[model samples]
Target: MRFATVEEPDGTVRCGVVESGVEGESLLRLPAGTTVLDLIQAGELHAAGERAQAADDAVPLAGLRLLPPLDPPTVRDFVAFEEHVEGVVQSVSGGAGVVPEWYEAPTFYFTNPYALVGAHDDVAVPPGSGLFDFELEVACVVGRDAASPTPDEVDIVGYTILNDWSARDLQRREMKVNLGPAKGKDSATTLGPWLVTADELLPYRDAEGFLALDMRVAVNGVEIGQDLLSNMGWPFEELVAYAGRGTRVRAGDVLGSGTCGNGGCLAELWGRRGAQDPPPLRPGGVVEMTVEGIGTIRNTVVAGVELPPVRPARVRPRTRKRTS
Candidate 1:
């Protein structure tokens, strides 16, 4: 079943099950004030979808604004593509393969859930940033709360296309301090078009349990790159389990499969060739991403407001200890 949250012409948000027929694509309204997360939390998402299908109030999809499939409580993004890592490492290190330690476990970072943008919303290039880029990714939403759950115990409710919008110049500085992606990445994240139930992807998984969906991305109508979801180093289950270790993950939490391999972003391309090409994304750029089984998500880049420079922190306490 496919689920989504949409805004009506009158400025009201409604949750629904998306259905496409010979006539056209339309949304079967669920109930007012109910969100995708609420249905999942109550274990009624699937059942609600079945009833929505037969309902009389089918609203045409045209003129409706898309929202994130669900309002995620938190977003955990992981580096799950070995080739993406290799290309980036080689580009930066001049000559180096992925570190052996990277294979020991999946690594991830938490991103701001409040900063999420809709599938087709306008994304502004954060002020003072010129080297903006987009990462092609796939994300899944948790279906239940769990702590230290094993891979099999991970309950992923649905999947969607994700755009990990980035400001490359800002990230370069942050990495040098070994601290944050903070303001560098906290600006915006894109999710939706809608969310498709995990079972819908069952046919797409290979014997090894890796998803085989075809993923593609384009900017301003030019295709930058394409890759298969099967190429991921670790599957979603493992990624979600790592996220839940030592902490409880609630329903509506999101886990992203990082960037895909072979030119997932402009930075990966520059690193592979040692020179920037096509330049970084800028104002007026339109990015569209499509993932098989889910759908397409597109966003237009816009200008952001400039802000005053942050005051640098003091180097140390004015009164240093006199002790040896």
Candidate 2:
């Protein structure tokens, strides 16, 4: 089943069941004041979906505005694609390659859940960033809380497209200090079109149990590249288990597979080809990403709100080295 959060013609927001294609034509409305998150937490999502299917409160999908499926409580994005890591690392690190430690376990970073952007919304180029970029990926939302659940024990409710927007210049500089991609990635993340239940994608699972979904990204109507979701070095189940290793993963939390291969971002291209051919995304640019079964999420880049200027870092002189 596919689900969405939509704005009615009256400007009322509600979660509903989207019927048919990625371009759904109608939405079977659920009750007011109830969100998809609430249903997931109460373990009534399937029941609600079944009930909505029999109701007569059908609304034209074209008359509604699609929004981010749900507001996640916490979002953790991981590097689960070996191709993406190798291409990006070598590109930015001057011919360096993926470290041995990367293969030992999936690594992830926390992102601002409040900044989740809608499927067909407008995004602003984060201020002070000249190299704005996009990452093509997919993510799964947790349906129940789990404390160190095994891969087979994870309770993933659905999957959706994820755009981990990047500010390369800011990220590159801050990461040089070995600590952050903070301001660089804090601005936005895209998730939606609709959320497809886990069982809906079962037929696409390959012999090895990896999802063989096709994924692609484009900038301003020009195709960047495409790859298989099965190419991921680790699967979503493992990622969820890994995320719950030291802490509980609560309902409504999201875990994203890192960027796909085929150069998900211009930074990787710049690293590989040694030129910024297509250049970074700027105001007026449109970024569209598609994942088979899940759906497509497209966003337009708009002018951003610039913050106050900052002074350069202070240079401290060497003074008390003998204490060591």
Candidate 3:
């Protein structure tokens, strides 16, 4: 079943299932405050969907505003695609490939879930960001306990497209300090169009059990990158399992399959763009990402609150105390 959150004409937000009719699409509104996360946590998705179907009021899709399926409790993004990681690493490190430790385990980083925006929303580039970029990827919402021996057997609520907006310049500078990507990525992440249940994607699963969905990204209606989800070196199951190893992956948690092969952001394209660095995303630039089985999310870049460039005060060397 496909589900989404919509804004009502009365300035109220509601969760509903996408219903198709002769006139485009409509939303079968569910009970008040019935969010997608609520259904997942209660494991009552099917029952809730049935209830929505019978509701009398069906709002036109075009008239309502869609929100990210939910405000994810925790967001973890992983580097699961080899081609994407390889190209990015080589581009930044002058031909260096994946490190030895990378193959031994599926690695991920926590992102700020509070900044998440739904499909068709406007995203603003953080102030002082010179190389704004977008990452085209897929994300899943956790529904069941991840401690199960067969992680893949856990209930997966649904899948949606993820747009990990980036500040390339800030990322490069901070990561050089041997820390994780923080401020550079904290701005915003785009999710939705709607959520597709796992059962709906069964037909697209390959023999190896990896999804075969094709992911594509375009800026201002011009295609920039495309890749197949089957190209992931580490599947979603592995990533989720690894994440729950010593911690709990509760319901509403989100795990992202990092950028796909050649999902060229300015950083990756810089090496190939020659002396002319690809222009950063400007205000009003539209970025669209589509994934089969899921759907397309188009976002417009807008100007954020501007701030002066970061400047830190110099630190003086201190003398060490002699210990007896």
- Number of the top candidate by TM-score? 1
Model 1 lDDT on a 0 to 1 scale: 0.88
The residue pairs in collision within model 2 are: none
Worst lDDT run of 10 residues, candidate 3, spans 269-278
Q: Per-residue lDDT of 12-69 in model 2, one digit per residue for the tens?
A: 9998898865556788899999899999989999999999998846777886778889
Tens digit of lDDT per residue, candidate 3, span 181-266?
99989999998988888888989998887899988888999898888988888777777878888767888789999888775455
Which residue segments of model 1 deviate by more than 4 Å?
A: 90-95, 320-324
State each model's CA lDDT, in order.
0.88, 0.87, 0.82
Cα-based lDDT at residue 108, candidate 2: 93
The number of clashing residue pairs in model 2 is 0
